[model samples]
Target: MTTTLAWIDYLIMLIYLAFVLGIGFALKKFMKTSEDFFLSGRSIPAWVAGLAFISANLGAQEVIGMAASGAKYGIATSHFYWLGAIPAMVFVGIFMMPFYYGSRAHSVPEYLRLRFDEKTRGLNAITFAAMTVLSSGISMLAMAKLIVVLHIFDAPFASLGLSSEWIFHASIVLSAVIVLGYVYLGGLTSAIYNEVLQFFLIVAGFLPLVLLGLKNVGGWDGLRHSLPTGFTHAWVGMSQASTNPLGVEVFGLAMGLGFVLSFGYWCTDFLVVQRAMAADSMTSARRTPLIAAIPKMFFPFLVIMPGLIAIALPAVQEAAAQPGKAATATSWPSKGLIPAEAEKDPKTGEMVPKYLRQAGSDEPLLDANGQKQYAYDYNLAIPNMLLHYFPTGMLGLGLTALLASFMSGMAGNITAFNTVGTYDIYKAYINRSGTDRHYIWIGQLATLFGTIVSIAAAYAAAQFNNIMDALQLVFGFVNAPLFATFLLGMFWKRTTGHGAFFGLLSGTAAAAIFQSLTLPAGAGPGIKGGWLANLHTFPSEMAQNFWLAIFAWTTCFLVTIAVSLFTKAREDKDLVGLVYSLTEKPREDHLSWYKRPLALGIVVLIMTAALNLIFY
Candidate 1:
């Protein structure tokens, strides 16, 4: 089960890591102030910013998770990337960037403070900090797990008789330490530069795997033959219920949410936002996200395609035939075999599937159908494929590419953490009169602290049964609420401080309740029996919390709009310089009607719709 690492593979990874560290060291000279450390002194050009933006967002989880989704849902899973993400980026580049950039704010919370109040700003910053730490840590852990599964250090550690568990733990800590060191030294500048390098390397590494995989799978025609009937169809395998949780079931809601949520992340999330915020001017900041959108449209071809191919491989089938190694056949938890089905029930002393076992077991076993079943570890699919399929020199490149993904993502999170901590917390609370040097040091300290906390979070994430599910569940609970509040804040100027605050609270509560109460213990509703049966299994602890948040947000929005009609309005003068102010610009009498962005957005939407229609 062990693969030998070629010298070239080790050399390439070493060189890549060294180059990353070199950039960090080189950027130290630019670290004279907090602004420079956190935003690259606003000197980055549109292209660099664009590349960094895309790279930073494509962490280890993306590579593995998308692949896992592909394995489970087929091409339908690409909706998250293509249908959900691209149009959103287009919207952000054309519309949202103007406001965010014009504000000249260091963090999203800082913008909140200017638009709302101090309490709102502080609350958001802390929440963001907590979520970022947890998300980034889990990402690091996933990347390290991939390395162990790929056997990158297999030969070197063989003499030590280390178990995979030991290797997994060591990899996580080691990867974090390396990332922390470079991020601490260079801040955003180093992170972005390294991201650019990592971006190219990851593509180079991944392209080969895709090509080889397609070839091994007997070409596109053969792949289709091996997969389920609806395998290539974008919407074929998805349950209508799975795609829409709100019961509203409108195509627009699905499409709009896909577009809106994606825009919210690429355009507004601090991790990606920091890239544009680092640009030299409004023009660069605005252009960077648009420029980044081009590659994002193409990512599915690289990231998701491999997962589709993974299921077609002979090895996966062969592995499934063994005593304890089943490939997941469905995305829904209840549809797949459970733990108790793979082992003997303790109470009755009868064999049960591992996934159905009331209590978990350390040992692996086989399902009744004689398939090897690792019910707890679906995320291992992509890494396992790499180990089996990639050749020697190629293996090195692939491993390096995976590591690059981890580095880029970690660097992005660290940059966001440092910027928010320095600008929002340090400036707002401690040492307001601090000198430039003092601020730079504080930024570095914040990054260090953030990295440490993230590492702990990653360890905690390992305990969860389904990493990808947990990640989405967490986002659904947190980001949905934030999205509601921000949406009202930007578009509805009549929204009062109380409205904004309560709206956020309500939206968060609503999402939390839905996520906790609607989702089953080991299964989401769609697969449990039908949607209704599954909904009954929703975790009680989180149900009321999410509902309350959503209620609060909606009530606040309504009340605020009402109050604004009767109350004295805030001076329009204070808001004149913000993003929405562009609408007030005098229309040019001779303005040309190129419609380039509109045309592009239309084309993207059409293409996406056409593909889905044809695929289904």
Candidate 2:
């Protein structure tokens, strides 16, 4: 699994580290006030904020997991982008940005307070702050694990007579310090600027890999011939749950991933919203997500093609020479470009194969050939692909880009955590009367605190990965119902705080109950669900996740409506600029058609739809 890196690679990483820190120090003069530190003084341009928005999400999962999914699910992996994110990004821009920008709320939970009441905001803020910290920590853990897995620090550790185990700890500290240094120095501005840098770094890093991969597989035509029938088509055999690699039918895919999960994260999650909120103007805020949607539409080609090539390489083709051979241990991971888990040979003191295990169980997953499945190490799909194509210097660039992704994710979470902690938690509850300067100091302190906590969380993640995985799902349960609260509170002027609060609780409960009752087809009792009664079986764990979101959204939506019918509504005059009906629509007449949010949004949707059709 480990590859030797040349001096050029180390130099590239060192250069990248220098620039990341340099950006933070360069922006230090701008952090005079609290607004500048936390909100970037709302001075960011639309294009800049737009790239930062998507890049904020370009963490380990976006870069690594998506590529893994690309290999696992084939072209259908684009659905996570084209189907799930594009619409939600557009919706947040034209429809949702007005209130977020106009209401002058400092954060999403603060908007909750303005729209509903203190208790609702308090609940969201507390949970969000906690989740943000945990998420950041999870990012930290992922970065460290990647470092250990890649053996990036093996030489240094060995030189120092240090145990290999120190690599994980060192990776964690190295990431935390870098993330903390920048965010602490320039706050969101530094994070945003660095995110923009990271975005380009990733693109620069991956574009060539994709090209090389395409060439290696003899281009798209060869790819098509080499891959399985459904692998090349995104929408083929998608009607039935059993037909496609995704395992979800169209209704479930469209409604669950497309609507509930997508809208919940994009429309309501403060992490990405914070990027837009930092934009300099109302027009810029609305345009932020719209601009992000442009590149977002075609990202699969840039980020996913390598995975396809990884799967359709020459070795895999040879393995399938016997018709209907299907993937086996030898060819499953493209001739061990993706490695199987390894153990030590006790007699020879050499490493041996450690068969990958099924989720939530001790049993190793076996393919149709009765051979143990290769490489549950999907995390390395993109990494190994880069190693396959890139030479010494370019390999350094690619790995640096990988490192950039980890930093971007960490910085994004930490920035959101500091802002919410300062504005929603501290200002609202802890120090309601602090001066702007005092709060700015607190904000800086909060950044440091958030980083430390994240580091701790990273260690916790290392100690109890499965528990951390479950905690992430638990947070998903919390967020699954959130869009309902946002949707109703914005559109309906009659929604009450009590309705929003209890609706959220009920939705979370519904998600938990649903998860407990259903299990994925081959999964066992545990985080993969079915602990309650196993009343229902889902086609896959992804399907279970989607359905859980669907149930949660529906429960919250209906409960909020019912509760609001008997609860007191805020007066129309008091709701101005906050409620959609009560507020005047944002005017775009002054700007050109392409410059307008609606016009750009329409174009984005059209392009996205066209992609779906072409791929379908």
Candidate 3:
């Protein structure tokens, strides 16, 4: 039987799509030139830019990933949101925002060119473009996978004796096409405006899920009773062997990677930086990230709390009782088993024996090996919870919010790609003589091309084990070193381009080696049996991976600084300007109330200490 979607659900989604397209069409007036298209005519207000920045950054992966982590690691996972991201946002607001805004660079790589040389700028631009495309593709693919699992659309083909896999493939293609169309129409302006709408929808849809889920789980007392000892204890279930491969301690691996990756993402990524750059003035740009930081402080409640509540649900408990059956039903194609036809409910038109359907009050769920499936797949937990808990009409709103996340993220990536392609690549190398109109056309073409490539990449990324883990693994290798280079460049002027380049390369190489050699296959020995392995297996592995990257970055920085001191300096005019600019005093009058860093610092300290205390 085919489940009929409620008209209200369809109407809500249609309205959202229309709203997004309307913004894109309206923003065309601002798109006469490439600058306007890619950077919102460089006149976006601080508040809009800030909202867009948060919206773009909070994609489906983040929403889903945080919930997943909460299920896997408990409240400790909150550290990533609070201690890791918030401080980085504040740092960018106070320090990095001014530098980027003052430079008036269209992209981060353009800043690199002004700070270093053309080669560095070109390399950074290419790397940023490549990473952005890959990440966006993976994110889109994951979103599609989630929708498929939720059975968002009718698998009519399945009912017609066709495979549901085709349904999955179609969903991905259709979503990508819709996203690319609007992004090509209007660049950052459309993206930012759409993001504003998405931000509200996501928050509105998510909060109820948390509250309702908690109530269903018997509130705080029931949750505590149902969960294992240490479930509420921030650090109760954490295992170094499972979560961290290098056996690094929590502070060393988690905190270090959090610090490095957060800075790299918030400070260095053009997706976020473009928003700051689009602000009207340096002060506005500076305040944008700071304003964004405040909202971020509350994200753990929205993202992490739901998953924690999910674990206590009676449905999840029933599923846990029948491991073998549950595993067989829900298992993906990777397990080398052909999927049996789904059984349908005659009245509801929903699949009756859907793998993730809630267990009857009397039935018990089983695990893969015919035992109780006590531990859930963290990745599947959130989707399973949502599908079971939400009613049909509310389900439409939830789905729209989820799609909004995907669209906002995709839009952000498209805008960043277009900005770098137009300003950094086309203007810098292909056609220095091109007019603003010419560059705008180039950006549109680039956006279209990027979307196509991202869709393909998304399909390929499906082969990976977990979406969030794949993204983090990629970031660990590529972004960790960039963090080092940016840090050195900002604080240590003596650092040379050779240092920056080599540091990034070394860091990436080290991270790759650690990932390959140290990360165990499935469940392997806790790191090569050594004296260090006994103390803590997981953190040690994580630490090894993180530190290797740090070591590579630091080694590169030192070598470059030492080499540059002995070697002759480049006669680059922009490099000279960068050096001079560092020495100038701040323009005092332009400073707003937030210009003082003390309040931000206090907030950062409180959040950091709270996270640590909770985890400890």
Best by lDDT: 2
Q: Write the per-residue lDDT of candidate 1 for residues 1-616, one digit (tens) a residue.
A: 4466877888988898788888888988877777788888899988899899899888977887777667766776666766667767777666666667777788888888887778888878877877777778878877876666456776657767876557787888777777788888888888888888888988998888888878887887887888876657665424443452222123433433464455556656888888988888766676677677667767876887787776676543322211232434322122221111245567988444455323255454557896554453445455556665777787787888888888788878888888888888889987789888888888889888998888888777777646645555555555655655566667766655666665666556555554444543444443222233234543322222233334434544465566556655456666654536423532323423332434445665566666557655
Kindly give the number of clashing pairs for every candidate: 46, 0, 22
The true-versus-predicted C-alpha distance at residue 575 of model 3, in Å, is 4.5
Instruction: Give the runs in model 3 whose Cα sits over 4 Å from its true position.
Output: 1-4, 155-166, 235-248, 316-375, 463-475, 520-544, 570-583, 588-616
Instruction: Write down the worst ten-residue block by lDDT for model 2.
Output: 317-326
- In order of TM-score, best first, we have 2, 3, 1
- Residue 138's lDDT within candidate 1 is 76
TM-score, candidate 3, is: 0.82
Model 1 RMSD, rounded to 1 decimal: 6.0
RMSD of 3: 7.2
Which parts of model 2 have CA positions greater than 4 angstroms off?
A: 156-163, 315-336, 343-375
CA lDDT of 91 in candidate 1? 72
Candidate 2 lDDT score relative to the true structure: 0.87
Better of 1 and 3 by lDDT: 3
